[model samples]
Target: MGGMNKIDEPTIERARRGDHRAFAAIYHAFAALVFSVALRISRVWHDAEEITQEVFVNLFRKFSQFGFQSSLKTWLYRIAVNTAINARRSHLREDARRLVYEKTAILREAGPDPAARLQAEEEANALLDLLPQEQRVCIVLRTIEGLSYQEIAEVLEININTVRSRLKRGRETLLAWKQGEPK
Candidate 1:
């Protein structure tokens, strides 16, 4: 809703009232944002695509429940975040199962050390992995997604102070870890 004009009101109303055409238009406008957020959360392209589709399907199913209190963009972001979180949880569970069952079996030959091939960008991203997931998500939303603290609070349904603290802690930890790393 940051830059959205009043022109979107009618489309939002129609979509809320179960108009497929209006909903499709809404989808067109926000699908990329939804997918991008999902991708950033899940860190998996396929999971992001699935989460995006699920978010739209959920929107259509619950559109009537929308009270227009929040912008459609914010609503979509909430859905995307929830979907991505669930998908990530499921993915981790599957990974745990694979690790337990495949511990004794070798599916493929071991590869060389991946760290040896790290590029500058990959090394930068590696710093992100040092933070906990919640802190990482806050940093991603604030810095990478360019959302304000209040905007992140709205989308995340948390207090603004929580967002500020997470960002502060995340930045401090990232810096500390980077400094502790060998050049």
Candidate 2:
């Protein structure tokens, strides 16, 4: 909602009317945000890319059903978060050895610097991965994406207090984990 003025009612109307250019414009505008959220949640770049594509597909398919009670950003956030959560659940059931192998391959492709920025990003993603998915979603939405509690609540379809609760718990968990880490 911050700078996503590209998804206004007129654009949505054009998309709903089967304007491919309008849909492509919406995808171009929001794809990065959606992909970042998915990658944060999933910790897999390819999976995040797929999730972004799926989100746009679902958005197009469900466009007619949108009631417009919330901002388009809110609706898109809902779809992205839900899709990422589902993908994470399925991913967890996959072979752990394969996941490790893929991660190693990714790290190798990241270059030889042990203290590289990619390592820092990996560490940050690992910390987020330590969070339960429910709390992690709230934390990412609030801290990383800069959504307000009310906006998160609306996007998550939960009470504002629920959003606050999740944020508090998520922060506490990250603090505890950080404290336990070696300096």
Candidate 3:
């Protein structure tokens, strides 16, 4: 396959047979690219680091399954994208559950000194949770991650106009929420 010069057949066979050095060589060659993709998609350094590790671990386990029908880079790219997106979705779901718990906890605990900062953060997160996944991701990449419109499009692998439309719809939804209107 194309771009196979970075990894030879011997190394692949060794890695498939559980050679640590062979695996390390593969990791060294692709870790940066994997991490870069993960960071762009997840927008969190910590999550990106975790995703990179998870990808390599997965590669080690599934090394024997490499059929060589495609370049290794392409396969790794697919894995990183899927892993990062799944991790982001999983995190959002966990955040939603945690938000429910925190809301209930706040209601139960009556105190004049409930931190305003924490309340504001929870409100922001709740507002974000109201958005659809696609729009929310675009909004986060644009607003929270400080990515440009073109950058968001590139990272999301979408057309620039699609990125713009998602951001516009997301903003409209947030505005409606602020105005106490039905979304």
Candidate 4:
């Protein structure tokens, strides 16, 4: 059963041809991780779920081109990141824009009292708002998701040095934001 933990690239290759079960298994294996990527990128559970569904739909649609150039997890995350960004952008539409804004506001206000612990989580999310999407994604992938620089580079399709630059710049930006704030 040890082999169960690993996806068979050959099986994936067959699935690429027309195997529905293989695709279903692949989806089951990666959905949570993809959802986590969506959540981290989006900073909201509902948006993440929506993004996760969209990612899977897109993945299945684009399955024939997966190419096996990267691990399935890496590819899945790349898809998740791309789809989440696109969906987040699309959420600005009349159908999604008002709902997104309203939901974000509700989450921000639905917390309990201004206790220090609660405030800390809220503050961190607030700080992330100050980051550009690329930097935020780099920090989240490196620090939060514990992906290697190479993995992040593959997922983001940027050079390794660019990942380093983004992580550094992201940390500095967060530090500056923190430092510039009232105590």
Best by TM-score: 2
lDDT of each: 0.76, 0.83, 0.74, 0.75
Q: What lDDT is obtained when candidate 4 is compared to the true structure?
A: 0.75
Q: How much lDDT does candidate 1 score?
A: 0.76
lDDT of 3 by residue, 1-183 (tens): 124338777887898889999999999888877886676556456777899999999999998898776556667766777788898778766663332323444455576756764485467667766788688777766675555786566556689999999999999999998899966
Worst 10 residues of 3 by lDDT: 96-105
- Please identify model 1 stretches exceeding 4 Å from their true place: 1-7, 96-125, 181-183
In candidate 2, residue 109 scores what lDDT? Answer: 63
Q: Residue 113 of candidate 4: its Cα lDDT?
A: 57
Q: C-alpha displacement of 17 in model 2, angstroms?
A: 1.7
Superposed by TM-score, candidate 3 places the C-alpha of residue 157 at a distance from the truth, in angstroms, of: 13
lDDT of 2 by residue, 71-170 (tens): 7888999999999999988887874433421355456665667457566777777778778889999988998899999999999999999999998887
lDDT of 4 by residue, 64-90 (tens): 888877887788888888887876676
Winner by TM-score between candidate 3 and candidate 2: 2
TM-score of 1: 0.79
Model 4 segments more than 4 A misplaced: 1-5, 92-123, 181-183
